[model samples]
Target: MSKVVLVTGGSSGIGKAIGEFLQNKGFVVYGTSRNPSNYKNSKFPLVALDVTKSNSITQCVEEVLIRTSRIDVLINNAGAGITGPIEEIPEEEIKRNFETNFFGPLNVIKAILPEMRKQGSGIIINITSIAGYMGLPYRGIYSASKGALELITEAYRMELKPFNIDMVNVAPGDFATNIASGRYHAPAKEDSPYHPNYANVLKMMDDHVDDGSDPKQMAQAILRIINTSKPKIHYKVGAFMQKFSIVLKRILPDNIYEKLLMNHYKL
Candidate 1:
């Protein structure tokens, strides 16, 4: 039987691309959306899911298992983005971002672990961000959330190793998707001290997404990981600079790397 793949947040963007690509490749693909009815034209079946909600996560996993009887691959792609000066962003919004980007994926994995354990095999891929490798101005909250997930996956990999279960992180740079429309932007108040820089950075961020690489590239990277016999713990997909930025951070001194980032963002 073809592998059964479950992609959270798969209704659109990178998740949608992965689902469609996998389905075309002969895998049984199921995507998730908060409102399944909204995606009547989605290429693969979309099940209802609100990643931040535990009950919704449970229901979605159960529904998929009922139909497929097994889930060979779990793609924790559901995430939310937030942008604002760390001090300016409301505490609640930061928490909410973590709830979606971090906790949500954990819950989904929890729900699916038992079945995968029963089958004696499974692969879990967490869709993180290149920004997670380093903090970016006005996007601290988003960076922190995704970065936390990256670390968590490292721990999970070792724990699941004996069970023959694999977990990896696939961090993508900007991709042309509707993520900008869905992201929560802390209002840039004209009277606030950060208004000018924050506003400029926000615009730059959106433009980057608008000009980002095709989501299909992410899908292809994912397909490669799924097919590999022993996948690496972390994979990055993006332009040369974006992926290289991570390498530079590792080799460069703290102050120098910070300077490079400041120059890039014009901060």
Candidate 2:
């Protein structure tokens, strides 16, 4: 039998690519989105799921159970972004960012844990980003959301180990996606601090996403995880050059690492 898998935000971009890839591999793919979707055709089921809302998430899971009666894998990929200076960002926007990026996965994890625990077998993959590891200008809120998610994924992995359920985190570097285009673009509020450098920071973010790696490559990485029997708990994907930043952080002096970032990102 094909393994049953559930993916959130599978309507487009990386999620969409993943759903297509897994379907071709013969897995029963159920992609979740907040809004109704018909893009995946009749072969794959595209279920409506809004991670921010408990009721919405619960209903989606129930629907999946009603259809397939089992879930072997879960991928929490639904997320949003917020861009602006840390000081100028509104408190409510930060909360919203966390709601979709962090708590969204938390809710999905909660919904699936019971079933996975009872079965004593399952894998959960959380789609995070390099921003989760290192903070960057104009993306404080987005980075914080991913950083929180990284810690949450690690803690959950430890907690679920006893249940025989595995948790994995996939942190990808810049990927070409509509997410960058739709970032919550809030310039410095009038009379707020950080008026200077706001445009430059946002511009850099824009440029990175515009020319980043293709979404299909990320789909391939997700496929690699699902097909592997002993799937790794964490997978980092991106240009090998990204390793330089990781190395700089680990080996270079603090001042030197900071300078490297400034020189690299043109900050």
Candidate 3:
């Protein structure tokens, strides 16, 4: 039987691309959306899911297992975006971002582990962000949440090794998607100290997405990883500079790397 793949937040964006690509490649693909009815035209089946809610996660996983009897791959792609100066972003918004980007994926993994363990095999891929590798101005909250997931996956890999289960992180740079429409932007108040800079950064961030690479590239990269027998713990898919930025951070002096990012963002 073809592998059964579950992609969270798969109704659109990177998740959608991955789901469609996998389905075309002969895998049984199931994507999740908060309101599955909204995606009646989705290429693959979409089950209702609100990653931040435990009951929703449980129901979605159970429903998939009931139909497929096994889940060979779990893609933790559901995430939220947040942008604002760390101090300016409301505490609740920060918590909510974590609830979606970090806790949500972690919980989904928890929900699926038992079934995978029973099957004696599985691969879990966490869709993180290139932004997670560094603290970007105005996007600090998003960076922190995704970065935390990256670390958590590293820990999970070791713990799941004996069970023949694999976990990996795939960090993508900007991709042309509707993510900006849903992203939480802490209002850039004209009276506030960060007014103009924050506003400019927000615009720049949106433009980057507007000009980003095709989401299909991400789908292809994921397909390659899924086919590998021993996948690496982390894989990054994006433009040269975006992937290179992570390398720069590792070798460049801390102050120098920070300067580069500041210059890039024109901060």
Candidate 4:
């Protein structure tokens, strides 16, 4: 039987690259999007899924079930960003971020675990972020969402270890993707709590994304892991700064790291 892989948010960006890479390796790939019309790429089995909605997830899983009868792997690569100060973002925005980034994967796991448990072998790959490690300025909500994911992944790995289901997290520090552009921007409040500082941090994030790692390289790395018999529970990919992001969090004093990050984004 051919192994099957389903990649959420696989219409474009990193998710699309993962879809393409896995297809070349001979996996039956199913890439998902909210609206089939919104996706321009029709290379794979493009299924209908909106991570924010449980009904949508159920529908997509149903389609996968009818055809494949078993899913070998699930890549939860669907997520959005909200770039703004923690105190400034509205409660609604935070809730929505959690819904899509945190609960969405949880919902998918719920729908698919029965199948995975029955099979006695399956993999759940989550594309988390380096932000899950250290909170970034103007990204409290986004960071929190991914942090929640890290915890969720860890817990699942521990509990499911004996069940033959593997849980993995790919934490990318900075990547060239449409993430910044796709972020949900709440309308700015004029002369409000967060203005120029918010604007500066957003710009810094944009600058990094533009010069970040090549999506193709990241895709290849994922393929390498897929081909391996034993894959690590977590893989962190980035340039020097990403290594620094973690090291600084550990060795450096909190005060020094705060000043360093602030200086990195200083106007």
Could you report the Cα RMSD, in angstroms, for every candidate shown? Answer: 0.6, 2.0, 0.6, 1.6
Cα displacement (angstroms), candidate 1, residue 72, comes to 0.2
Model 4 is weakest, by summed lDDT over 10 consecutive residues, at 185-194
TM-score of each: 0.99, 0.93, 0.99, 0.94
* Residue pairs in candidate 4 whose N, alpha carbon or C atoms collide under 3 angstroms: none
Residue range 130-197, candidate 1, lDDT tens digits: 99999899999899999999999999999999999999999999999999999999899999999799
Cα lDDT tens digits for candidate 4, 175-230: 89888888987655668677777777777788989988888777787777766777
Worst 10 residues of 1 by lDDT: 81-90
Supply the TM-score for candidate 3: 0.99
lDDT of 4 at 180: 83
After superposition, candidate 4 runs with Cα above 4 Å error:
188-190
Off by over 4 Å in 1: none
Worst 10 residues of 2 by lDDT: 35-44
lDDT of 1 at 89: 86
lDDT of 2 by residue, 1-267 (tens): 788899999888788888888889889999987765556463467899889899999999999988988899998999998998777678898888899999989999999999888888989999998887767777778878998888888888888889988888998888888887667888655555665567666677778788889888888998888768777766888877764566568788888887877676666
lDDT of prediction 3? 0.96
What TM-score does model 1 achieve against the real structure? Answer: 0.99
